[model samples]
Target: MAEIDPDAKRRPASVKELKAMSHPLRVRIIRLCGDHELTNKQLADRLGVDPGTVYYHVRQLVDAGFLEPAEVRTGESGALEKPYRSTGRSWWLSVQLEDLDTSQGFAPVEAFQQELAEAGPASIASYARFALHLSPEDVAELDRRIVAVIDEYVETDTERAHLPAHGGIFLLHRTPD
Candidate 1:
């Protein structure tokens, strides 16, 4: 497997691309495509949504350069099908959610929640809950360190593709006191 260069700069997502990624469905679409090529119909089936709705989201991802058309292949029914694959562009793009409209900024978190619900508690491999008291700089440091560790795993992921796919999210939010 190829190693990643840690110092390489990540591309910043453009306003258009950011807008395209603002919806929870679109975020989920990106995650699904990242795992494997899927046609609009297949995505609709997996997402439990109408094909028409998935088609719109797929078109948006395609336009934003997050998803690309893969080679046409014969389906199980021996019918020709066109599928889309994640371009992996989102992994290399820096998206500053704070700069986006507040209502649109939580797409990834919302998508994660939906996916977790679908996966159910039985699918959880591990869980943790904690409370921390930290200054702004400490919080930033904690986030940076945790992200670096996750990034290392992400960079080396293809080496372990044969393993089962697992999903996770990390969040640190202020307590409502």
Candidate 2:
């Protein structure tokens, strides 16, 4: 197991940074860039949005330090294109959804939903569903344990970058009556 540095801490997102990331499109942009560097035109094509619109959101992410310009490279058509890559800064920023507007707070979740749908059911590797009843303390402990496990994997993700990327979301919510 990789030892995590105890002194390392995730900083809370500032108002400006949080606002910059409060859009679902921006969240998707970050996720896509994480996989590889992408040019604005490529992003616009993959997202089925106007290049101008992606450029606007990309500018916002770059300003917020969530994305950075990568080395300029020649494309297949021998045209120079500037690509952007995710800075991975957002992974280290703690966002408190309660501090944001309801719609803004749901941006990440909405982005995940969209990505999952795009990936399709065949992409699902594993899944489980269950309901648990617990007191506040138990709930906190459960959350802590689950996060610790996930943190271990996240801390060492770069080691497995060559492997195919897998996405998962662990959501705990009240069961509807």
Number of the predicted model whose lDDT against the real structure is largest: 1
- Tens-place lDDT per residue, model 1, 13-126, is 899889888999999999999999999999999999999999999999999999999999999999999999999888777767577896577888899999999999999999
CA-only RMSD, every prediction: 2.7, 2.1
Scanning candidate 1 in windows of ten residues, the lowest lDDT window is: 1-10
Query: Per-model C-alpha lDDT, please?
Result: 0.88, 0.87
Instruction: Give per-model TM-scores.
Output: 0.91, 0.90
Q: What is candidate 2's CA lDDT for residue 115?
A: 86
User: Lowest lDDT 10-mer window, candidate 2?
Assistant: 1-10
Local lDDT at 160 for model 2? 100
C-alpha positional error of residue 165 in candidate 2 after TM-score superposition, expressed in Å: 0.6
